[model samples]
Target: MYGGGYVFCEPDVHGQPDDPERLAEFEARIDRGEKIEPQDWMPYEYRRQLIRLIEQHAHSEIMGALPEGAWITRAPGFKRKLALIAKVQDEVGHAQLLYSAAETLGKSRADMVNDLLSGKSKYSNVFNYPAKTWADVTVIGFLIDAAAIVNQVANSKGSYGPYCRALERICYEESFHLKQGYDAFVALATGTKRQREMLQDAINRWYRPIIHFFGPPDNESVHSKQLMRWKVKMASNDEMRNQFLDAYVPKVLELGLTFPDPELRKDPQTGRWHYGDPDWAEFYRVINGDGPCNAERLSARRLAEENGRWIRQAIMNPQQKFTIPFA
Candidate 1:
């Protein structure tokens, strides 16, 4: 379950004007709901934004595995342990698929990894927090994966053909992940007093981060307008977040669970959710790499990179250049 991402300002989010005729043609195709292929001509801004979005998404998938992976050995039973292991594997595989999709826009996986390690790239902000207990793992599995499905399902219909196709498969596989997560969640919600307490506490701690998951409200957010115009972003942050609340809030309520916010409710009149401030300041700070687990997460990844360097070198063919994967 990966949290959502925000792009930094791009040409002020309006984008710098491209060549007039080509821009018209590109936009006309998008207006007709045509998919944009990797080999097709595109504005430099479109390519840059897509690369950043997909590469960061790839990074998030594996990184998102970490918080839950820490609980694998300590899982309550052999069955749960096996499930966590399989889920972790699925998350890593998702990363490989996303990296290949990003590569279509011309960034190498190596370069993407370097940018991540150097702090030039970002992943989901919610993952920078620690998973404090088994209940916390369940919260991440159910709530976070639920949130990811909302975002990913929407993006499955996006204009970038490779990214759209990748998301289609991803969204399909994610159903099992969501089901397993909900299974774990329901088990705890119906368990003994201490188990129930653990679940509630996990929900309390995760509520704000979960609220922060879809990112800040649209007006307070930064993104390229051209991406939305080109269908690269299928929904606004507010739209997706509201959709999550509309669907999942009742599920939580049905389990006698609650979010920390008292103001989190749906408006009958406007058909929108009203949520208290979740502290966008914290969201920005976390995304900028100052969160509780940011350093630890990166340290773990860096350790893996170092430990595997020799194997990479042994397999390297210096004369070979990367060829973009064919669909």
Candidate 2:
């Protein structure tokens, strides 16, 4: 036994064991930090659930690019343009990481891409909204990225080895994104009054989606319990949302900017940040493909996929003349 758990002893029963005690021992082994390899016993639901969760996350990452990627050409300055390009590139990299994680559950990255294109899968609701101005870019970087980081930081400790490892890299990139956003907000808040007003409007526009990004609050959320039990999700929707608010609200105020929420404040005693409830109706509308910019985002995604078809085919089915020797 190890750590109050069981271990297979001498005369290992690879073929002989059909006993209930052996099953108990196997479960105990898992509980004791033992690795469950490809051949290990597992319930069917575990695999299916992980595939669903990872595929959804992968779809989100890929689609997440569209909102911010739209701004790469319109960024205000040379530096901001380069930074936006770099940020979009990071999002592409994140999609790759997430797809690799999903592939471990017997799915292909191409298949997941197809799912997203065909509208058979869903993504983060935040991306469905419009990036209306340069200020929208800053808000996306600050509030949207901040909301994503809360969920991703929790995922860095996931039980699935591939996902946990991928999240470590994603979190590192997200940290940079968060800083870039904060810097943008600072620049805007400290600029002319017009800049400050733009920043505030952007904050108001994104605030609700950022709050709802964690999903519905406890009793209303169906999948939260199972997701937590499997360690696929570490924090409840409301818990993660609150954590994001606590980290950013003070910084927003320090710059003499105001978020739209009148009920928002920090409790000096409990040290918790409080805010009014998000508009769940709008959240549903966004999730159901009815957001203000949903059609445009999806149309752009479809066009990109369509335009790249020849390129993909050319790479996958290389002509004899294009073949190079590996030597």
Best by lDDT: 1
Off by over 4 Å in 1: 12-17, 220-224
lDDT (C-alpha, whole model) for all candidates: 0.87, 0.72
Question: On a 0 to 1 TM-score scale, where does candidate 1 land against the true structure?
Answer: 0.95
Worst 10 residues of 2 by lDDT: 1-10
> Mind sharing the TM-score for model 2?
0.85
How much is the lDDT of residue 7 in candidate 1? 58
Clashing pairs in 1: none
Model 1 agreement with the true structure over 1-327: per-residue lDDT tens digits: 463755544553466667989989999999999999988889877788788888878889978998998899899999899999999998998898899999998888889999988778899888999999999999998999999999998888889999888888888888988988999999999999899999999999999998998887886333445578888788889999999999999998998888889898899999999999888899988988899999999988888889999999999999998898875
Give the per-residue lDDT of model 2 (tens digit) for 175-220: 8888888788788989998998898899888877777777766553
